[model samples]
Target: MKHYLLFAAGKDRPGIVAAISRILYRHGCNMADSTMTRIASEFAMLLIFQAPAGWRAERIGQELQRCEKRLGLFTGIKPLASSESRALKPKGRAHIISVYGADRPGIVYRVSRCLASKRINITHVSTHRTETSRAAGYVMLLEVELPSLRMAAGLNKSLGRLASGMGLHVSMRPVETAKL
Candidate 1:
């Protein structure tokens, strides 16, 4: 079996998953991993599937086009590259960086810039504005992969300075891996 990645997006509505899954079922594809979410008004999905031998990406694209036409969605399919199929394995510590402050521009910029300078890798990031406590509040949560040789103390110090200058609260802690 060969792996392929599918990207699908469309206006938010019910039954999108059913439509896509039905197509996959008809094609003898096995879904290995998938993520689906609504970012703003659009529904988006990224899926990885294993296709039986002789199943070409182009054929999948054609089937997905038919699905798009029937469901009023947009779909794209591509074969996953051998190198891209292997997921990243973190070496050192995993930490969560949280930032909260008055909603304003450049909060993500300033914070991410500092992390970038230190060669830190951001594995996941979720940012949003919410009405809690302050009238206008911004929150940023980032899952970071810290280098094995870097000290957490030094990284925290740098982040503290950056937060102070930006008038934001910043905290970094080791992320718990096990689930209860």
Candidate 2:
């Protein structure tokens, strides 16, 4: 089996996923992982899948090109190296950080900088902006891997300082993982 990554983006509409998945299915591709989300007015996807060794990159590209034209999507596919196909094991405990504040610039950059300084690895991030009668509100959720429990106290303190300095609310908690 050979692994490949597919990226697709276009206007948000019904049948986008179905159209793309149909092409993969018809070509005997098995999806290993995928993320699809709508950001503002656009939809985006990242998919990792395995295909039969006989499925050449050129063949896959041609199929995707047809699908793109049919669906009016921008699509790209690339083969994954063996090393890149393997998922990265989390190096530490997982945690979720929540940030809420008035809509303003630099929120993401400032918060990410703090986490970077602590060597925390961010696994996922999602943010939303809401409008209230009084003001625009922003909410950012970050899934991160913490180096150790010992740093939790200090991390919280640091975040508290940032919250106060930036007039934002920040909170974090460990993620509960299910044991199989």
Candidate 3:
């Protein structure tokens, strides 16, 4: 079996998932994990799947040749190594940060850079910008892993300070996970 990471994006529309899944199904691909979402009229996807032996990258490409173009999607595929024995999980506790305020530049960069400076890892992020609601001009939800929960208070304070300067509201809280 071969592991692959597939990315697909295009204008949001109906039947996109079915079309993509059909290609994988025909090629005997088993989807391990995937995320599909629409951001401002654009549909984006990140999929991890296992392809049966003998399905080369070129073959996979050929199989989707018509699918992407027909569906107006842009696609990319890359082979991924599955060496679990050599992988080590980062030492940290998960935290979710919420930020929302008027839309402007530097919000994402500044917040992300702050976490980067501390070697914090961002596992996932979702953002939305709205023109209809006055509640929040822009909103971002980020999932980050902190080196220690002991520093949550201090870090949250710093984040609050940073966000306040930018006229935004920010809050951070730990995420509880279950093994089973």
Candidate 4:
């Protein structure tokens, strides 16, 4: 089997997943992993799938292109190399880091820079901005891999200092991998 990645984005609406999955089913593609969500008014999907031998990325791209108008989505497909198709295996224990603060620029930049400096690996991140008549709020959730408990302790201290300086709430907790 050959692995491929697919990305699609369009206005949010009912039947988007059904339509796309139907296409993949007809094409003999078995979805391996996928993420689909709405960001504001737009819906986006990223899927890693496997195709039967002899299937070509160009062929799938053309097929998806024909459906773009009907589906109201901009789609792209890419063939994955053998190494690129492997699943991620982080070299440390998984953790979830939470950040909440007043809406401000540079929050992600500063936080991500700190993580990079610690050599932490961020696997997933999602952030939201909330607005009300009173004020705006920011929330960020990051799934990261910490190298060790010792490193986590140092990181917690650093994050404490960062939170105190920026007037934000930052916390970290181990993810229950067994539950996952």
Query: For this target, which candidate reaches the highest lDDT against the unseen true structure?
Result: 2
Clashing pairs in model 4, backbone N/Cα/C closer than 3 A: none
lDDT of candidates 1 onward, in order: 0.86, 0.90, 0.85, 0.89
Model 4 ranges off by over 4 Å: 177-180
Give the Å error, residue 8, model 1.
Answer: 1.5
Q: What is the C-alpha RMSD of each candidate to the true structure, in Å?
A: 2.5, 1.8, 2.6, 1.8
Q: Highest TM-score: which candidate?
A: 4
Give the range of the ten consecutive residues with the poorest summed lDDT in model 3. Answer: 82-91
TM-score of each: 0.86, 0.90, 0.88, 0.92
**Clash totals in order:** 0, 0, 0, 0
- What is candidate 1's lDDT per residue for 1-180, written digit by digit as tens? 788888889998898999898888888999888899997788999998888898777766777788898778988877887667667688668999999988888999988998889888998899988886648889999988888636678889998998988889999999887878
lDDT of each residue in 1-180, candidate 2, tens digit only: 989999999988999999888878988889988999999999999999899978876776777788778778999888898788888988889999999999899999999999999998999999999998999998999998888999888889998899889899999999997899
TM-score-based ranking, best first? 4, 2, 3, 1
lDDT of 3 at 8: 92
Cα-based lDDT at residue 154, candidate 1 = 84
